[model samples]
Target: MSTLNFRRNTNNFVSGSYDKLIIIWQVYSNNQWYCQQKLNGHSNWILCLLLNNNDDLIISESEDNTIKFWIKQNQWVCQQTITYHTGIVFSLSLNDQQSKVISFSDDYQILLDRKWNVIQKIKVDKYGLRLCFINDNQFIFQSFCQEQMQIYEMDNKTKQYRRMNEITIKCGSNFDHYSFPQQYVKSKCLLVNKNGKSVNLMRKKENGDFIIEKSIEFDDQRIYGQLGQDREYLITWDNKSKEIQIRKCKER
Candidate 1:
């Protein structure tokens, strides 16, 4: 419930709290992140969200079992909904083209078209908890209570996605997890939060394998990381003072 976001390629950010609210933050002429607007809609906790560059649109899925689409014109407001879960919609992910999406809830992994309509659904033994599109045709998925990490690819012939590969991930514990922006995931390689006190940088190999490249340590309590839009910086929570901190990534 302590999740937040920093937009890329622009001086804006977003955050969702346990209170079921979304706040948009922007850096105005003063070069400071300031609250620009607050969006209210979900009746329960906001579990995950996504926003693109212009920050004109946002998609957030909540524990209330619905995905709300928001648009910004005169104000930020919800315009559409994707609801199918009986419990918490743990994670949501979209491809770069915004033409395909996936959501995980309970024991199901559902795929949707651009309009938020369910196109496909799969039942799984382990709950899908976190997701990020590795590319337009490939995605990375993690389980809620297991160390398994998997990559899925869309089969052009069938127009369906299937598991391509898998690996056992190293989490702080079986429960430590978080989601990062997919745009940054493709560029910076990977976003990592090491039990909240440190963040590790990971880069993908030419073969599509990932390796830890660097580590950024923090004295604050365990916090997650979100890559800056440029992929040259990262933002994390300063748990001690309830503030946000930014760190620059050294050039490769």
Candidate 2:
């Protein structure tokens, strides 16, 4: 599986794969998972997947240079396909209010409204592996192989997003992959980012500044993990260790 998103309330999850298919899985009370549906639309590998707050909408990015929106009605159906990006769509992030979505590609960063209409497209100098919204009006984009992550904020006058600042991050190697997308936990005000060979944990302050809380380095660039929902632990697996490791969060 290339990307996966879980609906916390329903115990159902969706996964996208390298085979160019999206599978929805239903979890039973006995802890067994069964295939609920298989969605086919992308012509290439599915890169990223995001489920909306209500779990009724799914946005998927693919190597086919397209973003597909699947709506749940009778069954999951493709309601829209966005082909604005000329290159592979790398990442997709929905805002906190679910009023907008931001997508990063090899060519441009596109912003869309709730109705999935393109509102703005900004040409990026370097294609980032991950981009995510910190809040409703602010977001952070990590440039490929760059040591700094750019922050964009919405302008009060124009209502357009512009690059406001940057936060220094660790990029130990140029070697990169598709997994370990940037994730922000709102309840804890934390951001987990994987850049090159290190997973950097940052704390987002109320003033919109990010402070690097921790940086975990691995021998290999292939590091994959995620933060626990309770914000108490982080579980990760690396190619070098070849074992699943769990790290507890230290309170400051």
RMSD of each: 3.9, 1.4
Q: Give me the runs in candidate 1 sitting further than 4 Å from their true place.
A: 7-12, 25-37, 177-184, 188-200, 212-222, 235-252
- Pick the TM-score winner: 2
Best by lDDT: 2
Per-residue lDDT of 165 in model 1: 83
lDDT of 2: 0.87
lDDT of 2 by residue, 42-112 (tens): 99999899898888999999999999999999999999998888888888889899878898887856555
Expressed as tens digits, the lDDT of each residue in 1-252 for candidate 1 is 456766655677788888999888888786777878888999988878787546677888887888898987798888988776666787767777776677877646555556667777765667655667777778776665354566777899997778888755444344444444223365556645243243546577888786767655555534555766566677766555566778777765
Residue 32's lDDT in candidate 2: 98
Evaluate all candidate structures by whole-model CA lDDT and list the values in order: 0.67, 0.87
Off by over 4 Å in 2: 108-110
Overall local distance difference test of candidate 1: 0.67
Instruction: Per model, state how many residue pairs clash.
Output: 3, 0
What's the residue-level lDDT of 211 in candidate 2?
A: 93
